[model samples]
Target: MKHPVELLALKQTHEQCLAHADALGEALADMRVRALDAASYEHLDKDDRRLLDQFAYRYTRLQDDMGAKLMPAVLRALGEDIAAMPALDRFARLEQLGWLASADDWATLRQIRNAFAHDYPDSAQERFERLQAAASAASQLMDCLGLISRQMLQRFGDLH
Candidate 1:
């Protein structure tokens, strides 16, 4: 790749994104082991609380890095002018370029992330359901990152 230096930085961001996804995935796995309901959710053990916290933190970090840092870096590496592009514009451009599967999907994922971030469910049932939804969305987001990784490999033939 002509942009060896640029690809190197992209590679770093890509690895970091993967790490976040992996951690989130593990948390989701932990989530699945517990048959949590509203009541159960309210009385989680310390370990369960840690796992939930991990899930929330990793999910946000992964989305933020991918949208705010990695996506722009990817565009910049591909010679696109992304300095002024809104995040939605970046997603649309990536979709138009055949890199992203669908910008709409990305928007949905963002909504899920935002909902998980800001929502303080008044009902334990709502919190339980929200956690379930977030876990599914986290898995989908991880898949999206995997797709992006495959695309990167196809384009550059090995980032290292």
Candidate 2:
């Protein structure tokens, strides 16, 4: 691939992914210091709520960028035609290339992300459950980003 521009795009996407990953890590770490329960969740402090918002926003952003932008850029850089490939197939191909851990895990994360997008105002329990599941799944999303980052570094070397 004799395309410096593609490399530049890939580097930019990789940087965005890393930024999301770092934010997610910080939010999760700050959150873990004080665990949450049904009662505690009902009342979160301003900072805690902000952290939650940060985590939720970044989780969605990271996955969306990976699936929508980064994945296609990566495939193109690797000499694959992804002009018409669906999202899941893109994940499958990344997994095949050893850039992703499991396409299934990525799909599960997508489901969790979708849950976050919808609002059920009258259902606190449902929201709490989703927060619980998404928090756990958020770590997995981080892991996936880490894997892709390493693979990118190996393939492209010092994207910065």
Candidate 3:
């Protein structure tokens, strides 16, 4: 019942989401390593701080973009009303679509995103800890997205 072109676009977006998820996983691992190293040093050198800052920025940006792409795909596969659904309803839809286990963690991640976007400079230590936590949550979310993409491909077959 879906148009072939639309399906193709969805497939492409799904693939991109999967790829971004992989990148996020890698970034999360890197963040953990950096956090450990920073902790071991007991103080961040200027270069170390800069690296952490850059990594946190890129990790958050990529995670947000992945979510942005995913929302559109969900709308395409389901319906536009999904955009306006309550958080619980949205989570249920995402779960039904096999894209997430639950939405609770995602809400936390979104809060972290908002914090990073709006109030990152309150304290370096606090921001670092927040970014680390966000990285972990984003990693899990990316895994869910990857699973959904796989399920979708299996259900719909390869578009190309």
Candidate 4:
């Protein structure tokens, strides 16, 4: 039998990615609620805005890292040609395998991740909006990835 160390490592990484993705999703939801309350109640204080901005930045980075982790595992699971896949095509294939919801949100999340990582000095509000969308998509992606990981584990038996 194959040693299966690589498969086991990929599975572990997938689990970690899902955990971080879920945490980021929860933080984003909380931030969204706070944002809505602030809008309804009054303008957010500078400190509150800063907090949201920071969370958004961190969450975007987390999602990006999770995606990077998931992609290689997904390629291994499918035994497919990763290079042949376009961004959307890769997402779609994952979605078909129950590893994602759809390509649209995943693509948007990638864009948001790029913006947060590279585009500095953008308004807090803009970043917040992007984060909100990315968070929702990340949540869905987490669910799908978690399911895929579980299935993989079952197929190969538990990793030592």
What would the per-residue lDDT of candidate 2 be over residues 11-116, giving only the tens digit for each residue? 8988898898898888888778867676777778988788888988888888899889988889888888988899889899999999999999889889888887
**What is the descending TM-score order?**
1, 2, 3, 4
- Stretches of candidate 1 exceeding 4 Å from the true structure: none
Off by over 4 Å in 4: 1-3, 32-54, 81-89, 120-127, 157-160
Could you tell me which 10 consecutive residues in candidate 3 have the lowest summed lDDT?
34-43
The positional error of residue 114 in candidate 1, measured at the CA in angstroms, is 0.7
Best by TM-score: 1
Alpha-carbon deviation at 137 in model 3, angstroms: 1.2
What C-alpha lDDT values do all the predictions have?
0.86, 0.84, 0.63, 0.62
Which segments of model 2 are wrong by more than 4 Å? 119-121
Q: Tell me how far the alpha carbon of residue 99 in candidate 4 is from the true structure, in angstroms, after superposition.
A: 2.7
**Candidate with more favorable, higher lDDT: 1 or 4:** 1
Q: Can you write out model 3's per-residue Cα lDDT over 1-160, one digit (the tens) per residue?
A: 3666657667777666566556656656665676553244346678666656665665566557656665556556654465466656666667666667656766677777777667755555676666666666676666666676676667666665
Clashes of each: 0, 0, 0, 0
Model 2 accuracy (lDDT, Cα): 0.84
True-structure RMSD for candidate 2 = 1.5
| Top-scoring candidate (lDDT) | 1
Residues 1-160 of candidate 1: C-alpha lDDT, one tens digit per residue: 5477778888899989989988988888878886677788978899888889998999999999998878887887788887788889999999998778899999998898888889898887888888878888888888889888988989877876
